[model samples]
Target: MPTLETLLLQLNSIKVIDDTIPYSQYIPLDLSISNLDLSQIDIKNPNDFEIYIETYLKKNNAKVAFGGYNEVRNLYKQSSLFGDGQVNERNIHIGMDLWIKAGTPVLAAIDGIVYGFDYNAGKGNYGPTIILKHNLENHFFYTLYGHLSIESIENIEIGSFFKKGQQLATLGDSTVNGGYSPHLHFQIIKNIEDHFSDYPGVCNQKDLKYYLKNCPDPDLLLKIK
Candidate 1:
C-alpha cells in the first residue's frame, strides 16, 4: 500500500485560490473579510464572490488564504462567531476550508468519479456537498467537497467522471451553507462507511484517533505552505 505522503505526491495539485498570477504580484498586505462589504452577503450570484476573493487576495498579497488545517482553525477561533462552542471538543473540522468569498469555483484535486452528493441543511453544517472516489496506482480513496451551492448537486449523478482541476461546484453563502461565512470544506477520506452527500466533517473527541486515521489532513495533498 502507498503511504499518505506518496499518494499526495501522485495526485494533481488544486489551489485553494486562483494561482494564475504570481503570489507577490497578485496578493495584498492587509486582507480580511471584515474590510469587505457585508451588505452584499449573497456572493453566489455570477462573479460576485470571485471578485471579492480576488480583491482580498490582492489586498493581503496572499496567493491562498484558506483551505489548510491551521488556517481554518485560526479563523474559527478568532472569529468567535461561527460553530457551536464544541469546536475542539466535538473534533470539529475534519477538512480544510477555503475562505474565499462565496461562489468560488471548486476544482477536483484529482481525476475521479462522483461517488455521492447531498444537501445537509442545518446550522454550521455543509448545506450542499459532493464526494468523489479516486484510484491511484490501485489504491482507492475519496474526497469530499462541502458547503456548496444547491445548484452544484442539483443534477449530478453517481459515477460521473471528473478530470483533475475540473470545476465541480461553487461555494455557498452562510444561509445556504449552514449559516456561516462562505468557504469550501475539502476533506480526504480513507473509508466512507456507506455515507453519501454528507459525512462527519467534525468528530467527537472520543473518536478523534479513529477519525484522524480515517481522514488525514488535506494539506498532505494540497501542500499549501
Candidate 2:
C-alpha cells in the first residue's frame, strides 16, 4: 500500500484557490518571526496586512502569495484563541496559506465528499470552514478549507460531492474571517480523528511533532512550486 504522502506525490494538477490564476502568478511569502519586514507593520491589523500583501504582490508582479506550512509566526498574539501569553502558545502554523483578495473562489484539491462544515466564530479562528473526506489508493484522508465566506457554507450540503478544482467556497474578509486578511488556509490531514468542520491549524512547540505528522505539508498535494 502506498502511504498518503506517496499517493499525494503521484497525483498531479491540484489547486485549492482560484484555478483561473496560474501557479506562475503565485509568489512565495514569508510570515515567520524571521521576516524583519513584519516588524515595520502592525500584524494585528487586517487592513495593514492586506496593504502589505498588495505591496508584496505588486512588487513580485504576482496575484497570489503562498507558503506557511509549519512556520512559527507572531501574528497569533492578537487573539487569545491561540493562548496569548501561555507558556505553550500555539504559534506554529500547520497549514499552507494562499493570500489573495476577498471573494476569490476556493476550490477542492481533489474529488471528495463534504465531511463537515461550520462557522468557527471568534478572533484568530477559521470563521467559515469545510472539511472534505477523500479516498485514494484505498486510503482515507481529508482536506480542510478555512477562512471562507459565510455564503459558501450557507447552502452547502454535508455530503455534497465536489470534483477536483471545483469551487467550494469564496475567501472571506477580516470582519468575518476571524479578523485576518483575506486568505485560504488549506490543510491536509491524514488522521482527522474526532475533528469535524474545525481542526487545529496552529500548534505549540510541544505538540509540533504530532501535528506535523498528522498534517503533512500541503505542497505534497498542491505542488504549487
Candidate 3:
C-alpha cells in the first residue's frame, strides 16, 4: 500500500482556493517569529494584519501570500486559546495558510464527503470550519478547511459531497473569523482521532514531532510552485 505522502505526491493540480488564479501568482509568505518585518506591525489587530497582507501582496505583485506550515509564530500570544505565556504554549503552526481577502472562493482540495462542520467561535479559533473524509486507494484520511464564512455551513449537511475543485465555502473576515486577517487554514490529517469539525492547527514544541508526522506538508498535495 502506498503511504499517504506517496499517494498525495501521485496526485496533481490540487487547489484549495480560486482555480482561476494560477500558482504563478501565489507567493510564499513568512509569518514565523524569525521574520523581522513582523516586528514592525501589530499582528494582534486584524485591520493592521490585513493591511500588512495587502502591502505584501501588492509589493510582490501576487494575488495570494501562502505559507506557515510548521512555522513557530508569536501571533498566537494574544489568544488564550493557545495557552498563556507559561508552559505548553502552542506557538507552532502545523497547517498551511493561504492569505487572501475575505469572501474569496474556497474550494475542496479533493473529492470528499463532509465529516463535520462547526462555528468554532472565539478569538484565535478557526471560526466556521469543515472537515472532509476522503478515501484514496483505500487509504482513508481527512482534510480540514478553516476560517470560513457562516453562510458556508448554514445550508450544508454533514454528509454532503463535494467534488475536487468545487467551491465549498467563502473566506470569512475578522469580525467572524476569530479576529485575524482572512485566510484559509488547510490541514491534512491521517488519524483524525475523534476530532470533529476542528483539529489543532497549532501545537507546542513538545508535541511537534507527533503532529509533524501525522500532518505532512500540505505543499506535497498542493504543489504550488
- Strongest candidate by lDDT: 3
CA lDDT, every model vs. true structure: 0.69, 0.94, 0.95
| lDDT (Cα, tens digit) per residue for candidate 1, span 108-223 | 88899999998987655688989999987787889999888888998899999998877888888866887655777889998899787778776646677788888888877876
Per-residue lDDT of 26-83 in model 2, one digit per residue for the tens? Answer: 9999999999999999999999999999999999999999999999999999998889
> Which pairs of residues collide in model 1?
27-61, 27-62, 28-58, 28-59, 28-60, 28-61, 29-59, 29-60, 117-197, 118-197
- The RMSD of every model to the true structure, in order and in angstroms, is 5.9, 0.8, 0.7
Better of 1 and 2 by TM-score: 2
Clashing pairs in 2: none
Q: Where in model 3 is the C-alpha error above 4 Å?
A: none
Model 1, runs deviating above 4 Å: 16-59, 67-88
Better of 2 and 3 by lDDT: 3
lDDT by residue (1-225, candidate 3, tens digit) is 879899899999588999899999999999998999999999999999999999999999999999999999999998999998677999999999999999999999999999999999999999999999999999899999999999999999998999999999999999999999999999999999989989999999999999999999999999996
Best first by lDDT, ranked: 3, 2, 1
Candidate 2 residue 80 C-alpha distance from true site, Å: 0.9
